[model samples]
Target: MANTSADDLLRTARELFAVDGYQATSIGHIAEAAGLSKSAVLYHYASKEALLDAVLAPAEAGLAAVLHRFPQASDGNRAEFVEPFVDFLLAHRLEASIFINQGQSLHGIPVIDRANQLVQQLAHAVSSEFGSIADRVRFGVALGGAAYILAAQENWADPDDEPERDDEVRAALVDVVATLLTTTSTGIAATRGD
Candidate 1:
C-alpha cells in the first residue's frame, strides 16, 4: 500500500511537472491529481522539491550512465553516443521534458543542478571533437533538437495509444541526429568559402 501510493505520487508529480512546469505546479495540485490527500503526498515526498527529486532520480542516474559510457571527447564515430543518447531521451521522455525544458527556471535546486552538470558533461564530450563552430552547433542542434522533439510529443501524443510510434520515431531520430552530427566540414567550409 505504501509503495503503491508513493509510486502514484511520483507518477503524478512527473506528469504535472512535464506539462505544467515545476514552478507552476503545487503540492495541492499533485495531491488532487494523485487522488490522495495533500498530507498523503507530503508523507511520501516531504515537499514539492522532494517530489521533484524523486521523480528526477531515475533520469539523473540514466544520464550519468550515458555519460559514463562516453566520458570524454571521442576521436571515433559519434553514432555510438548518439544512439544511446536518443534512447535515453526516448526512455525518459517525461523526465527529459521536465529537466531539459524546465532546467533553466529550476536552477539552484541541487537535484536540477546535478542533472544540468551531467548535461554539460555530455555536451562537452560530444562537441569537443568538432573544432569548427559549425560542427559544434550541429552537435547542439542534433542532440538538443532530438530532446526538444521528444519533449514536445508529450503535448499531443498519448504513449499508450501510439506505442509503436516511439519505435519509429526513435529510428528516424537516430538516423537524423547521426547524419547531422557527421556531415562533412569541408562541405560546410566550401559553401562558406572559408
Candidate 2:
C-alpha cells in the first residue's frame, strides 16, 4: 500500500485545520484543498479525527525532541536552561501553537498521550536541570508567562496590526525570565539560610 495518498491527505488536512480550525473544517474542504476527490480523502483518512491525529503526530515528535534537548543538572545555573528551551519554542512556534491551542480536539488520541508523556519528561528534566524544587517552580512560572505573552501577541492580536520589532519582544521576554529566575533563586537561598 502506497503511503503517498495518506500523506497527501494529512498534509492538506493540516493546512485546512490551521486556516479554518477543526470545528469549521470538513473532509470535503480538505479534499478540494488537496485537489483530490472526496472519496479519495475518505479512503486515506477514514474520518476527520484520524486526519487530526496524523497532523498532530509531528507536534508530538517535536515535543519529544525538545524534551530530549534539555540540558542535565550537572551543567549548573538555571539560566543555561532558558536559551535552548526558548530556542526550541521559537523554532517550532507553529507546532507549539497547534499543540497548545488545538489539543482539546485531540482527546483520546494516542498522540495526545505521547505529548503528555513528553511534557512530563520535560518537567522532570527542568527539575533536574535546575537542581532545586523552587527553581523548577520558578522556571515553570516564567516560561508559562512568556508563552502566554507571546501567544497573545502573535496569535490573538490582529494580523494586520503593526508588527512589533522582534528584538524588542525578545529583549523583554529575556528580561522577564531573568528577573523571575533571579528573584526566585534569591528567595530560595534566603529560605535555606545560605
Residue pairs with backbone atoms closer than 3 Å in model 1 (clashes): none
Strongest candidate by lDDT? 1
Output the worst ten-in-a-row residue range by lDDT, candidate 2. 70-79
Per-model TM-score versus the true fold = 0.87, 0.61
Residue-wise C-alpha lDDT for candidate 2, range 29-142, written one tens digit per residue = 988887788888777678887777778777677667666665442335555656655665555444455555555675566666666666667656655545666777776677
Best by TM-score: 1
Candidate 1 stretches greater than 4 Å from native: 73-75, 131-133, 154-164, 184-187, 191-194
- Clashes per candidate (backbone, < 3 Å): 0, 0
Give Cα-based local distance difference scores for all models: 0.83, 0.65
Model 1 scores a TM of 0.87
Candidate 1 residue-wise lDDT, 129-188, digit = tens: 677777877876886677778877655667668544788999999999878876747666
Residue 98 CA error for candidate 2 (Å)?
3.0
Judged by whole-model lDDT over C-alpha atoms, candidate 1 comes out at 0.83
